[model samples]
Every structure is written in structure tokens, then in C-alpha cells.
Target chain A: MTPRVRVPETGYNFAYLDEATKRMIRRALLKAVAIPGYQVPFAAREMPMPYGWGTGGVQVTAAILGRNDVLKVIDQGSDDTTNAVSIRAFFARTAGVAVTTRTRDATVIQTRHRIPEAPLAEGQVLVYQVPIPEPLRFLEPRETETRQLHALAEYGPMHVKLYEDIARHGHIATTYAYPVEVAGRYVMDPSPTPKFDNPKMDDCPALQLFGAGREKRIYAVPPYTRVRSLDFEDHPFRVQHFDRPCALCGAGDVYLDEVLTDDAGGRMFVCSDTDHCEARREAGHRGEGA
Target chain B: MALARGFADPVHDAQGAFRAMLDALARPGLVQALPAALAPPAPLTSELAAIALALADADAPVWLDGPLAEAPEVEEFLRFHTGARLVADPAEAAFALVADPEACPDFSAFAQGSPAYPDRSTTLVLAVRHLAAGEGLAFEGPGIRGRVRLGVAPLPAGFAARWSANHALFPRGIDLLLAAPGRVAGLPRTARLLEA
Candidate 1:
């Protein structure tokens, strides 16, 4: 006899959102996929948490997640962080779905500020919590001007802004949330993730979705899509690097976060990806502490 | 009218169908198998019905063509399960269900959305005789790795030309979902049909 599965007794609906709202989001998501990197307006729903606390990612995850889906939540690349734990627990209680910290095992991963160190597969989806969906917001304060710019394919102003960066600083000064051109068309902001993860957005096997709750917008980059980071021939786009390996897992290639152990100048660099670090440690990889 | 048979478990079944549709859309020209549920009247395949159930709601107006539009069973099923309102005009439809690809209306008849809000365009769900890979139009776009081929049978004479015209619209054209028997494939406006 097969073992019976336990049913969730949570009062909330499946995934904690109504089917109507899910259908609405799913419709927007389909449009987002169709137009690759073009932001689609959605009926942004209010969540228990505030706007900046990943309400957008939560809504997107709720719409796409199934009962069998393995969910993974991350904040600043760590699964153990407060935001990650809170969102993961919210889904676990409402959806009664299995949650995994392993990037390889997760079918749906909701992230804020980082992509996983491990490469995502074809079937997996990465939901990004975007605070601002528009790359031109800072340049043009008015939505009317930006919409006209996109319609006319007038991206000269964007290039001018980047050129100004070179004029002011010796190199392109912008470090995180680098803008990218998608499918040779729309220019998209890949959330606030450090520029290190921008390359991972290009021609990736997994689908990437961005949702902004406050902005009431949703966008997507389908699998195998061309995403080129904005740069000039003289000053090419580059990622941040570290002179030393991770202090916890000894990962040299992955993105690292500098952690100050004490008030003194005693600081250690560690892998920002908690799952990657834990996996490395389990595999007998040790760092300065060990 | 007989009570139309719907998914036994609404949440799980709809989620399953939605995921398949999502995969199909994300990876254009890839044929994804859908659940064979609710065998509707003439012209409407099980795959199309499943998609309609998953994506359609009362908020979305649907446009239907061919014999399937006249079939009461199809109407009843959509009304009961999806609560989608049927519209006579294709342009006004949020989703258009085409029974026969050969007799389907011109691509321009449906909503291509606006310059400001391109996502408001209509999604055309065309019921094809077969959705497979082999000799047909080659596809290269966002979802495609190098190139993927999709062979859609019984298409109208001017489909390729119309598709090119539609694609030229860019960021503003109807997205397509092709269904055959138990499998479905996507052809978003971004997908370009290369010369065979």
C-alpha cells in the first residue's frame, strides 16, 4: 500500500492566494514571456508583508507554484537570513509544499539581490523581487517620457548617462543592478543584484521572472534568451573580484561578502550563497576558520 | 445540459496545466504534453480545453471561430469551468480560441495591444492537427538555444507571411499557443521563423 500524503489544514487558500488572482498573474506572466524583457502591468495584490519585503516575489511564486514544487527562498544569497526564512515559512504553512535549501533541488527559487552560485536547470524558475522595474526611472522621472522612449526605441539618453559615468570616473562607476538589453530589444534592469550575476542572465537555461509590487509591473526573460550588459567597446562590462577565497567554504570563483568579525580590522570574506557554502563544507572543503 | 466534467482536484490540475503552458511559452517550439482531460465537442481538443481552464476567467473575454464556436457543449464547459465571456469580435478578445487553423481569422483581426501596454494583446490558441518536429519552419529567438524546428500541419496558405508581418510589429502582436491532441507548443511574437 502507498503511504498517504498529509493534507495541509491551513485556513489560507493554496499558496495563500486565490485562484482568480493567480489566474490574473499567470495571464500577465504569459504576456511577459511572449515579449521577453518588456514589463507588463499587473493587478498588484497586497500581501501580509510590506512592499519592500518581497511581496512581489511572493505573489509571483504563489501563482506559479504547484503542490509538488520544491521552493527555495533567499535574501542576499543566504537561505538562513531573516527575510528568506520568513517567506519560506509562509509558503510552507500555506502551500504545504516541500522547501529545500539546495539550489539544484528547488523547482522554484524566490530571490532578493542574488542568483544562486549553482547554475539553474531548464525546468527551474527564478523569481526576482524587484524594487524598481524601470532602468530609466532615474534618468527620466516621468513615466510618459520613458514609455515614449521605449516605443520609439530611443535609447540614446541611456548611453549618454553611461558615457557621463566614464567622463566623471576613470571607469564605469556603477557596480550593482547593471542594465542589460534583452533579445536585442527592450532594456531591462535585472533587479539590484550585484553586477557579478548579470552574466548569468544571458542565455541561461532557466526562466527568469521579475515582479515589482509597488510598481505594479511584471517582466520575464525566457530560457536561452540573449541578455547583453550595457557597456562600451573601450570600457567593457566586468564583475567584482576578491583577492582571497571564502573564509567559510574556500570558494574562489563564487561571489563573496566581507564580514567584519570584530570592531577591529579583523575581517573575513565568506561565500554569500549559504547553500553553496554548506554544500562545500559537507564535501570536506574547509577555509580559514577550520 | 449535462454538467461539464472538470478537473477532479481544481488546484492541482490547474497548476499542472499552467506549468505546462508556462514551459511551452518560455521555450518556444518545444512540445509539452498536457493532461488529457475534458473531451469537448467537435474541433476543440483536450489540450486546448485544459489551457482555457487554466488561463481563462470571467475577467477575460474569449473569441471563438469554426465549428467549436457553435458547439453548445464547448460553450457550456467554458462557462461552467472558466466563466469566460464569449465575444463576437476578435479584436476585443483577451484570448481567442481557433477551432480550425485553416479557417482561422487573419492575425491582424486580434488585438495587438498598444505601444504603452503591449501585454494587453490577445493570445491566440490555435487547434492544429499535429504539433511535432521535423520538416517545417525553423525558429530562432529568445527561447531557442541555436535553432528549433516546429512542423504545424493544416495551417492557412498565408500563415508564414502573416507571421512575419505580425513579428514585424515587435513588442506588439498576438502571441500564439498551438495545440494538437495532447501536446501544446508556443510561438510568441519574439520567435522568428527562419527560412526552411
Candidate 2:
């Protein structure tokens, strides 16, 4: 059997970053909380792990972890996914913190793709792993230009790009990880979550943190923050999703990950967050758990 | 090769070089050489090599410009020792390394900090000739207690003007580091050059 745990015996923590690194990340986290939605550049250390693999989220979690905080990790909104399992196990060994799949119970939920269906409370912190932190990076090839645009609050080019896409494709082809304006100051990427989850961000009671390790940025949107998606009056915003309800939970409102069930294009929909689904199941709600 | 006692490899030097980089920025023009030992080919200073070894890692994504290929030994050493991703375009790099700032890439093409989170900027590490107490412009900002001066080359054509645009973004903009044989200096986005 492949050993699920892989932390070394000594020298560095299970992740290999030293206490100083965690302290630096901690300092950045404090600043992130203080500024609210401002992305803080940190001297990100290289983990034994690869990039795009929760390095940023791990750094944030490692920095803020104390003796009491409960930690949870999810990928594609499921805690049992291979990547989620790996990261959760990492924190368990290094920080020795309790790990739970239940969203309601976790103090720190390090996630990729989707946020929990259960409401995040004020005391809780949600950390997201970001592949690319910049929304304007694609539109403006130069960081120098994008900075100027953001400084000037000039998002004309972004609106143009989205409008052009709609004109050509009849719909904005963006499936997940759509961008949004945060707390009226920064245009932020809500990780890769489908737009179905975008509405959940407004005035949220819980603090949301975004980390892009490869990009070396740590930004946050505090609890009860304001977020708006950039859209023209002629082309209003619409969330993306399949027309079907969750096949397992039978819930019509949840964000559904289209699951292929048969060869003839027959498929099933399920709650992306497994913990919430499991909780619902125990509470006498079951769609068709396969 | 004698394996580094604690770290996986000696080239994992970025682990230590980061603190020095931090100090250089936190202190402003305060010169301190790198700790790791490295050798570079002609036109590349050992100081510059150390900075690269200290900053670049396997997971660093792209944005390679300047004399990396010009010095084949340095290139091979980096690839062999550090599994760093080679980004062909300067526009793509997380850390942009230059042996000589005189021929550095345009600062505009790199990642500047975004408005809401001006810290998402890219860091440019250039290998320069000597670092002295005189030269360049005076500086003051978040970290410095008062004003300080340092010696260095003038910005390339369109450099300072574009940088002014970057600076205007405040919390966003590129951070620069100038390294010599054993010393380094930082120019964080929060810092500004006071014209004499």
C-alpha cells in the first residue's frame, strides 16, 4: 500500500518550510487581514511539493495554524479527493491539528475549485489555491500596463474581452474561476469556482483568502465584504450550471459537477462538496449516492 | 558531490537567500553578499550566480531573460540542480534574472502588484558590478528610518517612466534586487527614489 503520509523525520516541518517561513507567511496573513482584499507579495518558499498543488494554501495554513484551530481541505469541493486527502494528511502530521471533512466544524478550510454549500461563519477562514492571480494578465500582456490600469481603475479592456467572447460564442465561455471586483478595491479571481458560487461571496460572514503560490501573491476578502462582477448593462451576468438537480443529493440548487454515468451520454449530477452531501445523507436526505 | 547537510541540495540556496533579500529590501541599499557558494562563467559574477541559486527553484514558473543561455555552464547548472520551469517569454517569469541590468528586459512586461493586492508583483534580480554608498538616487519609504543613497546604473530607456506608472499603482509594481559578488540591495514596490 502506498503510504499516505510523507513528512520527513526532522530538520523542517512535514512541508519542509521552516518556522521563519511560517512566520513570514503569518506576517503576510496579518497584513492580508488588515488590508482586506489586498494581495500581499511574499518571498514564497519552495515546498518539496510541486506548484499548482496547494503550495500557496499550505503556506497560508501553516502560517496561521495554532494549537487549537481545526483544519479541513477540499479539492473540487470534495474532501476525499486524492489531492485533498494528501494535503489534509500533511497538516495532520506537521501541525498535529484535528482534520475533519465537515465544513461546519473546520476553522480553516483550504480549498480548490468550490466553497462549501454550508454557510461559512465569521470565526472561520477559507483559503483558496489560485493558479493565476491576475484577471487582467491575459488581456494586458505587460504587468506594467495592468498595474496602471488597476491604479486608474480602468477595466475597459476586461469588459471588452468578455463582450468579444460573448459576441463570438453566444455565451461567455468561462466555465469556472470567473473574476470579480472585491470590496470595491481589487478585481479578484474566486479561484476556479463556477459562477454558481459567486453570489455566495457577497457580505459573507467568513473571511476568504486567496493564495497563488506560483504567482507569489496572498490576497483576502474580509467577512461582510462587497464583491461585484464586471458586466455591461446590455450583457448582464449569468451563472453557469447544468439544468439537472444533484443525482445523489437530489438537491436542485447545489453546484453540480456533471458526472458521466452511462455510455450513451446519460449522466448524473452530484454535490461537489462531499461533506455537505454526507451530512445531508445522515440527516435522511439521499439523492442516489453511488 | 558532497550533499548539503540539511537541505536537499546546495542550490536549494533560495531557502537562505530569501532572508538576505528581505533584509536588503527592509534596510534599503544596505549591501550584503549571498551566503551560498557558486561559480559562474565569464560575464556572470559569482554574486549574481548565488542570487539565482538562492531565488530560483524547481517550481518557479518561467520568465527567463538575459544571459542565461549566453552562459551555458550556468544554464546547465540551473537545470541540473534546480528543476526550474524555463519560461521562454519574459512576460511569463515569476522571477526574472539578469546578469547585467544594462541589458535587462523591459520592466513593463513583468507582473506588477494588482490594485487590491499590490503585492502580487514580480521580482527582478540583476547581477551588477560594484555596490557603493554613493550613486543612484536617495530613497525613503515603509522600511527605511530616513533617507539613504546607493550607487547603481541609471534606468534603461523608458525604464523610470514606466516604473513611475508601476509606482503609481502603489501596493502593486515590481520589486528589484541588485546583487554583486557577495552583496545585495532591494527596491521594494513600497520604496520610492527621492530625486536630488
On a 0 to 100 scale, what is the lDDT of residue B90 in model 1? 93
Best TM-score goes to which candidate? Answer: 1
TM-score of each prediction: 0.96, 0.59
Error of 1 at B62 (Å): 0.1
Worst 10 residues of 2 chain A by lDDT: A1-10
Q: How would you class the docking of model 1?
A: high
Task: Report the C-alpha displacement of residue A252, candidate 2, in angstroms.
Answer: 1.0
Model 2 regions more than 4 Å off: A1-11, A14-16, A262-266, A288-290, B1-196
lDDT of 2 at B175: 72
B99: Cα error in model 2, Å: 45
